[model samples]
Target: MVNITVPQNSPSSSSHYKSSPEGLPSPSPPATIKPSGSGLVKDYWIRSTTCTASSTADPKRKRQLKVDIPVVSYGHSGWLTSSSLTTVVEDPWKEVEVDGDGFSVYCKKGARDVMEDRFKSFVDFNGQHKQAFFGVFDGHGGSKAAEFAAENLYKNILTEVEKMGEVNIIKAIKQGYMNTDSQFLDLNNRGGSCCLTAIIRDRNLVVSNAGDCRAVVSNGGTAMPLTSDHRPSRQDEKQRIESLGGYVDYSRGVPRVLGLLAVSRGIGDQSLKQWITAEPESNFFKIVPEFEFLIMASDGLWDKVSNQEAIDLARSFCVGNDKLQPALACKKLVELSVSRGSVDDASVMIVQLGQFC
Candidate 1:
């Protein structure tokens, strides 16, 4: 299991949601599955592989670009089974320890769906290699999906990376996202979640994302988006959904697929399975010398704050006094988003790439 710094929810995380006894569906597993300490991994081996799109030069027009992001087959409705109890984290802001300058993470519960956003950060050890993993999940209807992904997604990524012998890191990240989604779906979960994950290995930073939760890096004082947001209203996403026989409708002044979920890609959502997917878009880059810091958050923060604004605020605070304080930066950003009016569940993480002082 990945060692993640989970955010302790406010008063609502425990009281607002249904318990595992109430949430767990039919076909409950045998008593033997639950051991003395080990949780869900004892009996289950999750499997998943997400698709990747590539950009190639057009045959006829040499300068033109051709994109190809493949999609894996999905037919695992039979695997749907039971889910574990809900996971909770205390404290809204704190420092998650890591080896040699690890990043800082901060989160704030929103008004919708029992503080649906969740995150995880840790170094992987159960694999052939060691890599730092950080993920942020935004749940739409409930916290179950987000919680499950946070607990199990990093492990799956480590598994896939080991399976491939680390030949292709991008493929492994994609597969990790899909595999986690599969595990959540198998539990017969109701809500879907937007996910953004960043993996650091040997000074390389790889970002993978499904749905709108995002990652932004400070490159030479400019906010550079590592993963693009996948909202249903986007032309490409709308076209893809329409091709799948799914239509996008406007409600509450926001475009949604079939007038339902706002994001086009995510985990769970059995009803929107045909259109919404777990496939993730990945970006690969080295943690160059120009890299200053990284800010990752849900749409609640992005909706109110731009990439530059967030970078400026965090950088200014990181170097304000005697020493760097990424934790403080994350806290300030979350507060700013709320002050600017973000009604959704707000979550933010600041990764200090290098010391500014």
Candidate 2:
């Protein structure tokens, strides 16, 4: 384990993490702001010391400036309080012409000191109001696998789409996964697998699985899973791995690969990659505009909570006043997972489609 210590700044100290302009107040107010909807609230706290000030003249004394105001902002801090959830209205797809077709994303890293997990990207092409959304990478063995997927999977898929054309989306998705896996192998000896699912042209969704991470779409309040869980215990996966010269170890009847890894497929774990395959197992579904919501989460979440349980929790929140359903759902999922004793790092992304979109 690598120890990374972040230096703490004293409230009175003038370090970069807590520096303000001369004459400005040190330490700014927390970033936590209430959500616009009723009974829904979101909050964030940032530790910093950059403040802005304004002066006003006293009513009785025309020549006297009697009021002093200080506003502070900082870039970094030691111990900051942040809500487990975040929602953004920005265009992850960066489509300008499409009015209401932009992407909405919500993310939360549950209960961990650091957010090592990553999320899929939703991007909109300039002319395509149809939209493209992807839940493409699930990191395992370490954060590197997840981070790499979050950062590059969308771009890789887009590139593949461009080269192969939309008629061959399945081919494009498969090639993209294989290419991404190879890239990870080349960059770092340690690699991870990804389970990718995407909504294309706002009509169909394609799912590709390589690891245990799961993607599920809520249809009329019922949970419909979009991808399969690729575990070594699965008969077909075990046969494939064995055919590739890989052996499964069963210690006390609990099966594991090499007695350490559990999943049958992944992008990294170079030592295991040779035995493990990167070829994605895929499925496709036509999306109904009336679909309630979509949930993508890491293994930490699924390990502790059932798909139906997560779906019910998200459905419960959907009826409330929270307009930021995605973020709220993610927060609730994380909380529930922690409550159920999920010690590993947990991350989730919820995407909700409005009727207008």
Candidate 3:
């Protein structure tokens, strides 16, 4: 009989998910067959070609002629079954505010998600500046890179702005980006990249794009791109890549470098570190009250969904619900992207007036 003993801490110990009853008897093993008498006798006999009459007469050879045979037995056992109960903890979403912009930011990391691509609304500088800043740092590679930008970019911008003053917001933005990149390189040994777009003092929207992630601004019910998507196919990007000793190849009529990655700009990627540097091209826009909303999303959502589709969806939710919040609208966009078969990590942030407070 086969006797199987399970440890107390085994998976089957859980009463809720276990299949077997308590203290059940083990199952029996398969029976083995014994050889017949003649076959067993033949198995012990030895036959050798070199045996001679003179050798047979030797006492040692005669004494050792009786061979001892060993019998081995084996049996089969049934399969063992077990069960386990797993407990998963869900993360919570929270709302954060940025002073008096009448805007509130709500952020949540979704199911099986690791990256957080949210932002804090701009804070005033020494209580003297009237500018309200808001930004979305879309991260690629990992959340650490994005988190690094989201936490430090604004502070870096503020510091650069203090030295350069209002005359050089673009320059300051660039300098701040470089500073942040250097800091990331120092801390992580590798850095992550981000697409940064900030609304400063509620009057200017400054954007710095590095990767394929995008920032779009909705104006008067029309979608307008606030920043260009930095892809490897772009002429300037291709030239920059090759200039930095990287090669671009055409595979199956599609232009690709190393036949895999698509983006032109990113942090880390130390393998392509020569091609990647932290010099950001800054574009500044004068914000008017006419600006309806700003939508920022990772490539996962943008790759599968159109800009207009996202805008329409967000607008629909905003118009239908009298008290619709922009952050909630952003969440809805993420949900829609998932429903549309976007298997990649998806994140979206929407900024609109009157709903942020």
The lDDT values for all models are: 0.64, 0.53, 0.50
lDDT of 2 at 64: 35
Please identify which of the two predictions, 1 or 3, would achieve the higher lDDT against the true structure: 1
lDDT of 3 at 78: 19
Instruction: Give the alpha carbon lDDT tens digit for every residue of 1-357 in model 2.
Output: 111121111111001111111122221211212223332222223121111121234568554333322111221122233222222222111110101122223334333322334555443431355465556354454445666665556567768988999888888878877887778888853436456555556566666667776777667776677767666677788888788887877644446666556666767667676667777777776666656777777666677777777788887766445553545567677778778666545656565544314
| CA shift of 212, model 3, Å | 2.2
Stretches off by above 4 angstroms in model 3 are 1-113, 116-118, 123-130, 249-260, 319-321, 353-357
TM-scores, each model vs. reference: 0.71, 0.66, 0.64
- The backbone clash count of each candidate, in order, is 7, 14, 9
Q: Please rank every candidate by TM-score, starting with the best.
A: 1, 2, 3
**Candidate 1 ranges beyond 4 A from true positions:** 1-101, 124-130, 319-321, 355-357
- Candidate 2 lDDT score at position 337: 71
Candidate 2 lowest-lDDT run of ten: 9-18
Task: Tell me the lDDT of model 2 at 205.
Answer: 62
Q: Report the lDDT of model 2 for residue 322.
A: 52
